[model samples]
Target: MVEVTPPEGSQVVIEMWSDLGCPWCYVAKHRLRAAIAQRPDADRFKIVIRSFQLDPRAPRKPEKNEQAFIRAHGGTAAQVFQAERQMQAIAREEGLEFSLDRLHANTFDLHRVVRYANDDGRGFEFFSNVQDGFFAGALNPYVPDALEGVAEAVGLSGHRVREILASNEYADRVRADRAEGLELGATGVPFVVFDRRVAAPGAQKVPGYGRLLEHVAGPVPSERVS
Candidate 1:
């Protein structure tokens, strides 16, 4: 497991287990960040992104369209249509774009790269950029070059990014993260633990996350009267 130490003076450490291919995880990320920004002591919170793969056996390259992929995975055609529409609406509410044309492939490599970024202290930025590119249909991360593009955009070294992708570096860290999440009772993506005490499963609304923060970390201190 990647050992993460909270920043100096950080009061709450939030560990979120999420899969990049999951739209709800993308939306939950935005909601959580929005909630954090609303707090006066936002800087006191530390967020650690954990890796989870919704489809561990998926192919490295996307061979089917989104509809076909969902259907092949046991989702009925009707269910796929309804779920995609609902998720698009929800993503819009969170100020994020969702596309039904997103690539469906194994995220193990992506997780490995994220683990490397986490160790390098650029985890969130790299993860967010990759998610944005993915859901926007602007880039296919399944391609090595596109993945390298995201790493470069996040200020990660090009050579290091290529090296990690070409080898098994950080692969064990990714697996360890997913195992830890399951041990913590995560049955799905977007599972979050606040300070390792409060366990929140699934995608929670912005205000719900706000309440959680307040409950675990206390309310923002009231501004002093002049």
Candidate 2:
């Protein structure tokens, strides 16, 4: 088991567990960002992005569009289409566009990049670019150019990002994040922890999140760890 020390008595920590491929995770992230932006005590709010795998057994390479993937997983056309509509509607609400029919790649490499960004203080910007590239720009996360573009956008070396993806750096960090998600009883992506006192399992409403932030902002959980 991994050991973590929760914040000292009055610190508010937010840990977000998400998959780069999950549309709702993207939406949930924005809602959380909004929640933080509206916080009365923004200085005390800490945000940490954790990792989760929607398909733990996903292939290393992306083979085709998401449509074929759905079928391969035994999803019916009607159901898949409906899900696409739902995703698009929500994306629109969140000021994003969705082309769920486009190619979907394994996010293992991209997530590693984000982990690096976190260490370098560019996590949020890098994470935003990854989602924007995939869900909005229809870019394949596995492609070197797409991944590098995000890196460059966030003031990191694209070449370095490519190097990290080519190697096994940060792989353990990704695994640890996933393990923590399971420990938190997260059955899906977009799992959120507020000061470690409250756990939100999915994409929640914005207004409710704003209120939750205010409530959670008051007291930190006792001896909880990220």
Candidate 3:
């Protein structure tokens, strides 16, 4: 269990730059939640996950397995295998079931769909799906049908998702998000900016987050100081 205190006059806003297909980002989200749970005034903080595509040029449909995808994306065969083991370990620790076999290497279409979801008052829907679909379900997020399925799973309109896929609206927003992500110094997925001051590059432990949040709120004052 953790202890919490009332929020100070200052509020904490977290700008999270992440890629939907990044396993590390999902783990980071879980760690962030743990930190929030420790704070009594968690409501004083607003967290938003922005988009940052790791593979901006990825095709709409990738033709590779998880191992090949990782290798093509800069990691070697051994490295990819090690990463898979690490991902499995982390998923287990987080109490999440991971389906790595079902994952596809592409994320462009998935990202485009998410942009449309934002406009339909379900901005969080696609984001939530990516978190689960990529990190847990290990589904090919770039496929149109897969993305549509994700939308349906999240209670969003499947028809709308299909419509977005057919149009250019969603793709434009994906471009915008990528631009903003770069401007915000998020060159990689799962980059986090906390309290507009502290920044973390990837998935960190709960204690690190706790310390950061505490700094944002400052120290609790004694009654005599008041």
Candidate 4:
């Protein structure tokens, strides 16, 4: 078990690189929540969700079959089914519903929408909406209607969303985030770096994450006893 004492004054910054549609990312979010809940100084943690695209060039609406997508992720049928079960169990733990059957591979538009949502003072709301659409509503967030629906659910004006989606203004921001993710050696979703010392990729479990945070928050005692 890892022992953590929150920084007394300064908040611990956790930069999370996650794709909104990634199931592992979703599970990781819940795991983080659990860690935070256990921490005595949970209130001092600040989490920033950064954008990362699993497929930068995925279609506006995924035209490929789910099996094909799964295979490309190095996912076998057995693994996929196991993930399905795990996801279901995680959703239950998080008190959320996640349906992978209706998921798609397209993420460009969704990322663009997040840009607009960030500008509209609805970043967290928009993020939740997107998460809900994918994990609960069983909606493919890349479609125009689904994207718009999330924006609306987050209280972003329809006009602002339409204008932003029509233009290329936020495209570069999203692109830059993805580029940064790549530069950070993030090859998979839910990559997190705590205090620049511990780097974990792909939805780390609670024990590992908590240990990393604790290590970052303070010095670990030397194992060698004088």
Q: Estimate each model's TM-score.
A: 0.91, 0.84, 0.77, 0.76
Q: Please write out the lDDT profile of model 4 over residues 75-103, one tens digit for every residue.
A: 67677777777878877776778764655
Q: Which lDDT values do the candidates have, in the order given?
A: 0.83, 0.76, 0.69, 0.71
Q: Candidate 3: where are CA atoms >4 Å away? A: 1-11, 67-78, 119-122, 138-140, 152-155, 218-226
Residue 182 alpha-carbon offset, candidate 1, angstroms: 0.7
lDDT for model 2, please.
Answer: 0.76
Query: Residue pairs in steric clash, candidate 1?
Result: none
Model 3: per-residue Cα lDDT over 43-99, one tens digit each = 677676666778666555554445446645776767776777888888788887666
Best-to-worst order by TM-score is: 1, 2, 3, 4
How much is the lDDT of residue 204 in candidate 3?
80
Q: Report the Cα RMSD per candidate.
A: 3.4, 5.8, 5.4, 6.3
What tens digits encode model 1's per-residue C-alpha lDDT throughout 18-60? 9888888898888999999998788888788999987788877
lDDT of 2 by residue, 1-226 (tens): 2234444335567788887778888888888888777754566777778878777667766655555457457777678778788889978978877875566656777778889988887776788777877777567777888878878888988888989978999999998889988887888888887777778888998876776676666432344477
* lDDT (Cα, 0-100) at 133 in candidate 3: 62
